[model samples]
Target chain A: MKLPAKAAQPNSENLPFFEGAEKGDLVLPRCDDCDFVIWFPREICPECGSQKVSWFKASGKGSIYSSTVTRRIPGGWSKVTPFVLAYVELDEGPRVMTNIVECDPEHVSIGDRVEAVFEEATNRDGESGPPLLRFRVTES
Target chain B: MSIKGKAFIAGVYEHPERHLPDRTLPQIHADVALGALADAGLSTSDVDAYYSAGDAPGFGVLSMVDYLGLNCHYVNDTETGGSSYLVHAQHAAAAIAAGHIDVALITLAGKPRTGGDAPGGSGRAGGAPEAPFESQWGMSVPGGYALAAQRHMYEFGTTSEQLAEVKVAASTHAQHNPHAFLQDVVTVDEVLESPMISDPLHRLDCCVITDGGGAMVIVSESVANRLTRHAIPILGTGSFVKSSQSGRIDLSHTGAVRSGPLAFAEAGVTPNDIDYVSVYDSFTITVLITLEDLGFCERGTGGQFVASGALRAPHGELPFNTDGGGLCNNHPANRGGMTKVIEAVRQLRNEAHTEVQVPDCELAVAHGTGGSLATRSASSTMVLGRSL
Candidate 1:
């Protein structure tokens, strides 16, 4: 299945998360003070207002909290028709927006077990971009 | 210190044409501004405060205020997606109550239909914190809401037919509205038969993309009393933004769960006291979920509440979206907040179409949900009562 072009530009706050993706690792930030795992990695902890956030490798295991099979794709992603977009609840207690891949789009269900799979994105110019972190259903 | 009865909705105007490719964005803004001022028996000179959202073109409030030639002292460009206008209404009323501004004008306009950009299209600024994590997935507007609908169905046993009932009721009201984009009444089967844009949400479940706009004139109590038009009292207003909670997301509820109670508490009324409602119907699931969040029914019972025809106008226990709502009516500029308030004003003024007009409608609620239902979203609720 075709994936959307990597449109995210790495910044100072989120650069670590991208750097981890380059090594095929699902890295997440956790607040040392509050013990809150921050999704969409940021510099400060939203819970405790602490800049003392630490990065660690996550288990890469999660369950589908909710999902939708998008039949109508928009703009440049029209080529990626019939893709399953979902929110996966991580085993470490954070939810991440991701695509459920390597399975029939229609067969994906809420609460299904999934694991992180980093796929390299390529633009029309055949230029490679950052590895996109997607999820695939794990065998029961 | 409450804004209750301190300010009133003096005038409201919804642009007639759903498609206006020939008109520029500023022209539509001017049209609605003048239309509302005219309806209030006021002029541009009387407008001292101007309000707008992100839909305002160019420099936002600065450009619209100068283009409209309004000599204003108070200006607000607070944007919360589609719910921005409702938040503006609340802010305008507060300003009026505080004696900062007597007359406030709020306008919204967009050409998304002609421009071919759906609301919430990939318009996020580069380097937005969420973009790195969420943008990679092909998440469309419908896709986000479909996730919520799927979870709701899994947890509450909500059926597609029950969700389709929302579209049926909207189409029923649209048939009475001559200017409605889709005036032909439809059935549950038709809604089901429509192609699924996203799983659990059919094409019929989505709102129309219109190029027109709308405006409202809110005034202080003294200004409202001096006007000839029937002024609808602004009883209470509440707003809240619900986000992913740093990844601990719950799809079962919306920000309405908080905003509804806050508004109801300030209005000194319960949900039972509301005579009419205009909940934003960006999707059928939106109406169903909002009804529960707004206390119209118990949680997990919205399916049965809506399927029982409670939203049908003229006779339902609680008539809603008498203007066909965004489901069948015009979702101008991809923002339904302005139209939601306009229809509530229409209902209170007894100016609604004879077929869908709620008899002796006194108190009404106009609520809007902006942004996506499954992701970060804003909910604004306003309570209105007929002037004494």
Candidate 2:
């Protein structure tokens, strides 16, 4: 029914993406030399091997490339059983792993249009961390 | 020069005990190593090269080599998750072909069943680039493969029943393996009736976790000639790493697309020439996608190919995983590649159980997939031929 409570532990390379999520925006790194949009946020462009990468606010809109309804949650998270996990192919041409929320888990299908939504989560130390990016089905 | 025919798998051994709480990790490694050495009619003193992966205990290759008292001139601890052993075999073959070393010893051991949590149970720690992006979500091992299965069904009309056929065939073959973790034959309906762990992948589609390990002894031409046991020649070997390509990932295929063709080309053999195959069956969907990638059938026809009982041992068009594979046999240390190579060696030697052994099997392929299919993964494939 909900994403796990674990928070993203941001580092120097990905700190910008997590900072953007805190501001309710989906930001991604793009290769300045080759125009490649890097996913999982890295320092160098995997395509051109260029270190000239910059961050920009994305459209936050995408379609589901693939999805799965997880009935058995590991790490003793069975209370939130049957949640939808998916890879959304953003309009900017990068796919991200996120949760599909705000709809029945069974209703989520491949190619369904979705929009990014951020949800706040608390870390193990009881500190509120950066919001996690999830997706919800939207009208085409 | 190619590694084809330069090295032979002179000996192989798979630990019979699925659960060994009394044994230590290094002990298990030593057990399989000695088992394989004895099979090859060689002593520990004959080993000059050592290969292992992340599953190796303590300091990896150094720990195992010293613990086993192996005086090696060359060593490799290449880590490709479950496919590490296959990759090791490929590397060993290349090393032998290059005349860098002879008598390479490869071993794998893990006690996931008696040792508690499977490897990588905890999320990646501290500054793993992908950890921040994907680890927070509920991405279980099955969930990753389910994503691929979901997309495959969406694009290719593959059904749950078709996927069940893989499990059915594995269970059927597993019935003949006394060391198999699950020996009961299952049906399509039974697999479908099993609880869904992740969508499109039922509990039955997953491999069994066990506490065991396996070992292999690959040697040079001269070493093989000196050994009394039947030597299965390593004809061709290829390994490739497939990543998400910075989010341009295609869930429909695997790294086998590159590795398989490379191996076949080097071996000068086609898929039709393979008398048996040992595919890493981490899950049923894994087999379906891999078969397609390996060019066994058209890309989307794997559903029909497998559902037709092509993977069943003894009488199928291409008997596969005659030792039950990771699906029903054993996934030692939560890694299945070691056993994949072990079984292929058995088939090439005509040493597999009579009920599941392929008759006059002369050629076989042993393939392994490491990491998750939906994310970054590694594929290793080897073509083996019966010794003349």
Candidate 3:
């Protein structure tokens, strides 16, 4: 998917998560000491402050923890007005920021069942990058 | 050690014009500073320390000092976004108590409407230092607050009408203040009918963008004793920084719950004792959530609490945001905390305009929320009174 030009470039802490997205997999960091899955991919576990962490792929299905229909589009997002921006909680734990697509933005709500899907988007510069993770209602 | 009631805001002034296309940022700052000094019955020579955030026009303290010709021993630019000024107030009070400086001047100015580049938006940039995952999905400032409003409705059955009530109340108060940016009274229906910026948040549900600024002068108790003007006491102050992007926040509650109590505890007062309030209303949801977190009502009941027009001015149960709040009055371009503090000082001193003044308002609470709603917000709460 061609991400927006302003889309945050992945770094050492979150490079693996982006790589997972590019490969059509949902990867996350887990602290080995406390077995806690961390979102936003941090080098150290916030729970135990343990540097001993590893990355793992997980089941993509999860429920919508919270969702919003954003109408204000800045720069690159002008194409997708009134899109469903949601925090999807994975079955393995930890909520991720992804769009709830393939459904009416207004129809999406908290506690709705959703699953991740990957799509390619190109920026205005015609630069195609990683496959962005998006979610869709599963119960429907 | 608590730094409560040791310092006083002896002087306060705000730029008269809400939108000054002709004036630059530093010009606004200098105007307000001189006005506040006059209000305090002092001259520039009396100020020993200075505090500000961000930049004025294109310069910082060094240029401002040279331009304003201020001679000072202590200076700080502790920028914490909108709530930085409130935190500056807290820090200044402590510094005075510690004998670091005698007279402290804190100021804020911006030309958001005329300067083209107004200050506001999400909490912080996405990635690296913040939650990369959240920022990567393209979350805007209102988008984050929308999530909280959504959760509130789901959990408490809060309706859009309840949120609209907040805007109506602010607008009603603004109608009484001539300097307010939007003084026309708006009904709940009108608020609900406004265009949607984000889910569950309409245009009126959000704060207006305007160009304005305010300034304050704080002095040690000893310095205040000799001043002729009413020196509003800094009864108590509290601050908390909670990042919402990375941490697992409930989204329903915020740092206000922790910070509000700290201010109240140090002030030796309860919510019921507060006669007036000045809370940052970056959005309608901001006010509702803050009222609940501040212990004015039980969690999840904020919607109902504000529904009865209890927060409206000119005779509401609680005269909140008497300056019309950010919703109707002004947001001072980028920073909002300074305006809230200014209003609380006005209310406590019985100096507020006759229309919005709270009768015998001896105690007031001024609160500000900075950053984004998704990631934890930085909440600052202060309790001010007429006398110790």
Question: How well does candidate 3 score on lDDT at residue B294?
Answer: 93
Which regions of candidate 1 fall more than 4 Å away from where they truly are? Answer: A123-126, B121-125
- Among all windows of ten consecutive residues in candidate 3 chain A, which has the lowest summed lDDT? A1-10
The candidate 2 chain B region of ten consecutive residues with least summed lDDT is B119-128
Docking quality level of the chain pair in candidate 2: high
TM-score of 1: 0.98
Which residue pairs in model 2 clash with each other? none
Task: For residue B150, give model 3's deviation from the true position in Å.
Answer: 0.9
**Shift in Å, residue B357, candidate 2:** 1.3
- List DockQ, one per candidate, in order: 0.80, 0.86, 0.58
Give TM-scores for every candidate, taking all chains together and pairing residue i with residue i. Answer: 0.98, 0.98, 0.94
Give each model's whole-structure lDDT.
0.90, 0.90, 0.82
Query: Considering only N, C-alpha and C atoms within 3 Å, which residue pairs clash in candidate 3?
Result: A1-A120, A1-A121, A2-A121, A2-A122, B123-B372, B243-B376, B244-B375, B244-B376, B245-B375
In angstroms, give how far residue A129 of model 3 lies from its true place: 2.6
For residue B111, what is the lDDT in candidate 2?
Answer: 86
The candidate scoring highest on DockQ is 2
Q: Local error of candidate 1 at B285, Å?
A: 0.4
